[model samples]
Target: MKPHSLTDRPATLNSRYNRLALVSSPRHLALLNKEDADTLVVICDWLLWQSAVTDGWHCVHFETALIDNHAPDPLDMDIMLRANDWVWLDGVDHTLFHGVSLGRQFCSTAQYIVSAYYRMDLALRKLLSEFSCREVTLYDYWVDRYLVSPDLRHLIVATVARDMGVHFDDQLDPVLPGDPALAAAPSTLGAPPTGWHKLAKQCGLALHGYAMTVMVAVQRRLRPRVNRPLVIANWNMVRSFLQSDPADDCQPMVLAPTLPKTLNLLRRFWSANILPCPYPSVGLTQQEREQIAAMVKVYEAHWSEPAEGLEEAMRRFMRASVLTLDNLLPLARQVKSVQAFLRRYRPSRIVVDGVKSPPLSIFLELGKAQGIPADYIWHSPLAPQNIRFDNLGCESRQEALVERCLSWGKFNDMWLERIGAACSSVRVGNPVLAKYTAMKKSGGGRDVALLLQLVPAFSDVRGLYLSQYEFFVEGVRQLNQLGYKRVIFKMHPSMWREEYYEEIARRFELKVEIRKHGRFEDYVREADLVVGPMVSGAMLEVLASGTPMVAYFLKPSTLDSTYFDGLNVQSDISRLGEAVTNNEFLDPAVVLDLYCDSECGQSPAERFWQALSRSPL
Candidate 1:
């Protein structure tokens, strides 16, 4: 059979004609003068646009700037058109102008020509190798615009061309095309593929395809409405989980909530109940209550339940649902609630927030007896934060026991072994990091902000209270020593109680600004650096923003050494000076490795998702 020729092809044959033409915007073309030409060539292949160039086909490369009536006289249209059959190079607004110019230039010359658009620089680099051809032409213009790196641009081009089936002459580069799993592949991060595998086996649990579902369960709470970092992390986990499966039993769900406000947004995505176990006096307003009700309605649609008394409601939800318990209730109450709920729901897993809640003994007993997987959902930094309150009746024994369990060197290993056996821990990134990235790009300025969780240093609450004041004083002193002028301190939402701000000022003898409760990312974005001693998770948020952090570790009496060891805690005050100066210690990849590897387990979100997937209605 004879091969097909361009002349014999139908004027509008869809199979022969390229439906997608990807040209870079004017901004990208300007970058060509600055970037390595070889790199540009490589990018074209990576973008999958190399085939068309090598075939000596008519490919038009246009600059958006030139098409906007910005082309200079004495233009080298021939040099531009040397190899390609057609070329139109324009400046900014070229996308608009190119359409007009193309119509006038090719009006009646060709039988049929469909204009498929792309950016200018992308198109040039894609067709640069075929510059030996003579029929090429160019329209010129110039404009300043930011362009992605040639390497990244190449990958993008290749992906688009691959999807469009137009072979670009560029070699294909590995690109994470909006698939978190491909981005989070073990090879991508240079980590072991079986990292979660080891964790599951250690936990002595079966690998159920529940993690992806659980990710869908709490994706809202874990992510923001716009540009959520946790979404990326969740995507990566979901992709990994799906690929790990040999069968089609589990598929990932993308949770996008159509809510205006942050409060109700979570309900749109998750069926799991989020009991806002705030302090007693922290009452919800009428509007807030109505919003919560609306959210509940949406939540109940997929995971519905009958209304009952508080105890029974907790029991029923715990039994049937994947329980997410915030640590506020007493140890006995918390354990009993979980136990009762588990008996009814027989849930596949549980996530307990707040490190100070239930004792380790209770969790161990529950795990040993019921084979129910459990993990922590930390929301604060691991370092101390300055706060004061009178602990009138809180017990210390439970605190001590919990601290001991967290500190035990073998506890994490054992827990990992147990949990890792059946279900893998999903490594979800912090959502706050995503928020901070947006805030910074907008040029919102707040120099230094501290997120403080206040609690008194009295006998009952002494265990929970570390001397964050000392760390703050030291942090301020160091910042001053390093010649930083302005600093803002954001009090944790819980610290709004009493005169915590006044007390902090009195004790520290420094006029630190007390910021109002708001999105933590705003503070992170505005501030140059974040300082705290005990807010590990919050530090994770800061790290996500690629911000510098100065942490002061005030060793609590009952604190676990293993927890500190796992953290690779940098407690030296001098190190803070170095970190502030170098600004290289706060990379999330480094921090994640330190934290994730500390305990052979998946991320909290990952574990939660795993549980949600296995729980029967």
Candidate 2:
């Protein structure tokens, strides 16, 4: 049956059993038929609207159903890997960013829209299967409104319904008083900066790029034949260098698009060869703009339902791909600028966090062209098998960009080998771990630091809201029962939802301290025990700090099975207090040996430098 929109006929709540009504926007409850059902399945942060709905309605929350750990979900990854057709146009390969087929980037950007469509489809199917319901009535404005772009909302909702064979109701009628104008399409491609703000940013970037280029020229003249390794530094690299005391010989010139405050500190103390590679607002040539427009047309018109299902949705997804091509013009500009910089100065080597990123890979490719070998430092903890490393289908194609990978330790090296990463792996250890190893451990106490992972609501990270809810509400309740008098709630560095944490704290009536700032190491040293409910590299860092750590999760993850294999990983929130009490933490030395490979004589920074020196191009 075809989907139906609202009419003058008012929809009334039905009390029939086995009937389910999934509500994305519940404001117009008067218009909802409730599927002539006994249940109301509220998707995405249902807790906020739970009290408003009818009592005794069986509700399944969106977050609770899908467990997200910030890492790529298996389903999401499968969706990404399933498509090879979207990038092909006519006979030639349209799957390229600059001169390379950046298949991973293209798929990932397409997924920003398509994944949401498929996920909603999955959610509906799952709900029907669990409830044993024949038909599901959808009251959704969430897709229509909350999506990053406006044009894709109706398309996604309609596509999802048809794909699932569910009776789709477009929207509830008798609009809520203050609801946003549904017809208004805000610029799908984000609004560029206007007036003085735009001008200032452009001028700043241009000046910074020129200044860095001049500095490199002067440095080349002053110290001929010096081994100047150019570092395409991100925050992680800057933080690593900041923590470690690098030798004079190991200093690499830093090149970043934007300089965080920490980089300024690094420049003052460490090396002054820091420059901003002007990426944003790069002046694109007319030819490049025309090329992007042409590519957009091809991608927009192209549609192939890969054998992976979601056939009807792929068409809209292809159209959505047009929006992401905005990056193409900027990428071309970046590549041109980088080529000039690399050719002029001729850095001895290129150092970056990873070779997988499209932007970072540009540096690697350019460096390779100029005979400058690239070295990628293992920045984060190696995630476990299946969900992360396995089934990517693209890493094998991209790994050749880097000449060598400076790994964290044996586990990373082994995993890299297992995954068939083309680069040779060297266990140079991590500077952050080395520093953590020397830190004075906190004295035994009941105080616990709970690391929170709070992803933005309705984002690609599925079930993230549920993860936060369980981490805060359920986790705090469990801690209180255990008689843990003082609990410090450490917000994820990327988030600052103190108001949400405070609200949860007030509800629990527990003595909780919400910490929005402070390094991960600082939290480990201050608390007697570190408990991270979400998957994080900091958990590995906690292991190196000699502090007892409990990896808590609502469901078993790759991290639980692999990294913290023998350690205390509690999936049962109720048993968390017991696990904390038992405190059978992993031995720091063994953990260090496996993950960090710490050296007694030399620092990790020094070790990495030595490894780089040993590995000749």
What overall lDDT, based on C-alpha atoms, would model 1 receive against the true structure? 0.33
Model 1 Cα lDDT, one tens digit per residue, 1-617: 11122113222212222222333232223333322222221121111112222333333323211122222221111111111122112222111110111111221111111111123333333343233221111212111111222343444344434443445444222333222211011112335537877786545322222332344435434532312111111222323223222111212232221112233423423343222111111233456344434433333442354432222222233323212212112222434543443353333333333322222224334543565544443233222222110010112111111111111113233343432222233433332233444343322223554534322222111121223333445555566566555766665553232244444445446646666567766677667666664334566566656665655454332233344444444555445667666653444555544543324343333333443343311
The lDDT of each candidate is: 0.33, 0.54
Q: Which ranges in model 1 have alpha carbons more than 4 Å from their true place? A: 1-267, 270-446, 449-466, 480-485, 495-511, 555-579, 582-587, 597-617
Best by lDDT: 2
**What's each prediction's TM-score?**
0.34, 0.77
- Candidate 2, residues 1-617: lDDT per residue as tens digits? 11111111113323233545555454645454444356555444333333333343344454333443345455533334444344545545564545655444445455545556545555555555555554555554343213433334444455555665656665532223233423112333457999999999788766656665565556556666556677675666565665544444434566645465333553553353333333333466787677767766665556433323454445555555443556566566767777766765567778877544556767776777667888878676544432222112233333366777788777777666655556777667777665676775754676565545533222233433344455566556666666666677887643234565575566546567888777776777777766664345676677777777776544423222555566455666546667767875556667667777764445666666666453431
Error of 1 at 252 (Å): 13
Q: How high a TM-score does candidate 1 get?
A: 0.34
